[model samples]
Target: MPLSLPERPIILTGDRPTGPLHLGHYVGSLRNRVALQSTHQQFLLLADAQALTDHMHDPAKVSRSILEIATDYLAVGIDPDSTTICLQSHLPALADLTLLYANVVTVARLERNPTIKDEIQARGFGRDIPAGFLCYPVAQAADITAFKATIVPVGEDQAPLIEQTNEIVRRINRQAGADVLPEAQALIPSVGRLPGIDGKAKMSKSQGNTIPLSATEDQIRDAVRRMFTDPLHIRAADPGRIEGNVVFTYLDAFDDDHAVVADLKDRYVSGGLGDSVVKKRLEDVLQAVVAPIRARRAALAHDPGHILEVIRRGTERARAITDTTQRDVRRALGLFTLH
Candidate 1:
């Protein structure tokens, strides 16, 4: 039997257990998750199943990161008592809904999705894209609707997935002639996307440019030292451009003192601040931010049993909610259930 949902706005947001979540994940979504868990019913899905879309050959890595990312969440102050942290593979209804949704969205429509196109090109899959990779948006739709998630926190690049989820919701609701699934809204964080230290691309695990949640003090300082700044600003008196400077960008994202960041930016642009000075400030800030999280992650890593227990309990709770939705969706579509 399925459990009943709490009477509140339900939020479903998570990360693929592909790697240790980085500052990008924190700035983009994790911070918001921590805040929303207090006001909304939240579920953090360690997306092991979805991670398999690109990592089918490395299932072990996917399984391993489940614990790593769950620890990341806990270290970042995501209270397991507040947020239900579930493993995606343990939720059978998600796969069932994915199969059902696959029939709703056309292949051409999937090909036309901008997010899907960008990912395929970035991965260099060309014409030989994996079927699972191509159909992940459908899978995401299932994950969202199965929990009846009304709000899905995501980055700007992922807004298309929420739209696609709504399209599926409309399709299913039409078949059922009622609102069986609530469409989810993409709540983009104010910080947007955090770029890598090189300013080449977004901070990503695959790009090897990420500062992990468990990054060491030395690693944090080193990453900040190498952060991209204006090449033209060769000396302390040379005017530096903050337009593409990754340092200011991170400062803006992480540093709480807006006035100080503005002053630094002004000095940088007015030909007085050196890159080292700016980098030093950023390094200190990042060190402070990452030190506590690193310690918490280290402590959590020592207790693998505690991590497993958290995932186990959350998965069980999530199964009930998703199972209830699955049965409702089945009934709405007029599919006969084995009662």
Candidate 2:
């Protein structure tokens, strides 16, 4: 008889526990996770090991941010009952799978990954890049295949990583002479990317441009006040350009009132709307979104013990799934000898 498949697809997605998640993260994946959890078996990973690929000097920071990322997950309405939040380092199976998958991929392939290249340039690590950081794509493949995840939600820039993962999956199955691992498809977000307050193409913690999900009202207001706008619009009478306007980009992503935002865009271009007016509107929209998240984070903060318990439970559950995958992999590769 053929095997039974799950009614709902399994989804694998996560963030590096290097810092608090930000507005960019919410727009990119968090909102989608909240909506998909009830309909799918979702596995949210706290990728501490991957974070260490770059931040090896500060292991303590990774430890601290595990709870921070989990709280953000819960604050954003990723219910523990519906979503299994797992820590990447706790699953030794993932490490083993990563090693197995790495054998199938060439150094040339890893070097050619666009996401990896962009990261190497951004971090200014020309020749001094860590080998673990360079091979993270394989580790990510392990994370996805271990859960047999059919769908992976990620940003547009990460689409290349998904492609690399599928390549490894195909190579491994062909080598093993069986379809042992499932291939995953990337579910790219509609609002694919969010720019930094400084008008950079991406918001990043290293750039110091992110507005954290747990930010206070004052912090939100301050970030908004400093947001980049058209530099040429010197006065209220001057026509403003919107080609690279970060404020308008943010408004398009966050503000729900389409007609109102459209009107604001028209007024700004035609020469009467001031930057302050647009910034205030963005500030209001962001505060409305983050206020409830902030409140929930505050409440969750009061009970660190509860947060740790949740992580422990999810870690145990994730380990069992990965253990099965590891056994299958070892057997397929003819490495499972009787002890």
Candidate 3:
């Protein structure tokens, strides 16, 4: 039988369990997830399997970071009651679905994926890209379709993955003459990239430019102090440029008072506003945001067993849903008799 669509849209989104979550995650997707949980049937995945595509050599790191990532989620107010938080590896059906979908997509199509291309270049994998890494998009398609997620929240860089996922869905539906998989739409957040303290375009842990959610006041202060600003503005009276200023960018994203931020920007562009003053304001704003989260994470860290229980429960619930999808997929492909 063909799978039926849900009355309320299902949202599927998650993070790779490589390390602790950071400000980039908060501005990009974490805030949106907290807000959308009430309105949609949401499933948040801890994509350890996806993380392994790149970190295959460090299996222990991936294993150890699973609970840490889950703690970050809970710390940021992702209620387990409202959101089903599932680990990717726990759901065997996703792998089965990936295997089935692999034959439908061509190598040329995978190579054309803009996100994959960018990642390959960023990782400097000139010609030695792992087959597993190359095929992760197909697995991601399985992740979305298995849950029948209508909305998949992602960054701008990942928009192409959603497109490729829908293409596979359409191809399979046309070939099987059944809507075995539902297409997912990408929910790209407005505040996409949070520039690193070093003024890099993106903040990543590997780049040594992330402010983790659990950072202390001292750490936050240190990061803000070293934030990149206009090099030309050596003197306090020198006119500054805000175009590529990472400090101002952080203010624009984090500071709630629009009028205050606008006034600061005016002063910054005109001169007389020192980088220290701006950095102080940024530090204050960031502390206000990260303080509560840090407190929550610290409190949660004391009860590792409870966090593990949450993952176990969510995995059980998610497996039931994916199991049904797998059974339907098997029937559609005539792998087994539909009893």
RMSD list, candidates in order: 2.2, 1.4, 1.3
The estimated TM-scores of all candidates read 0.97, 0.97, 0.97
Report every candidate's CA lDDT: 0.91, 0.92, 0.92
lDDT per residue, candidate 3, 94-124, as tens digits? 9999998999988888988999999999999
- Residue by residue across 85-164, what tens digits does model 1's lDDT show? 99999999999999999999999999999999999999999999999999999999999999999899888888998999
Cα lDDT, model 3, residue 24: 91
Candidate 3 overall lDDT versus native: 0.92
Clashing pairs in 2: none
Model 2: lowest-lDDT 10 consecutive positions: 1-10
Report backbone clashes per prediction: 0, 0, 0
Q: State in Å the error of residue 275, model 1.
A: 0.6
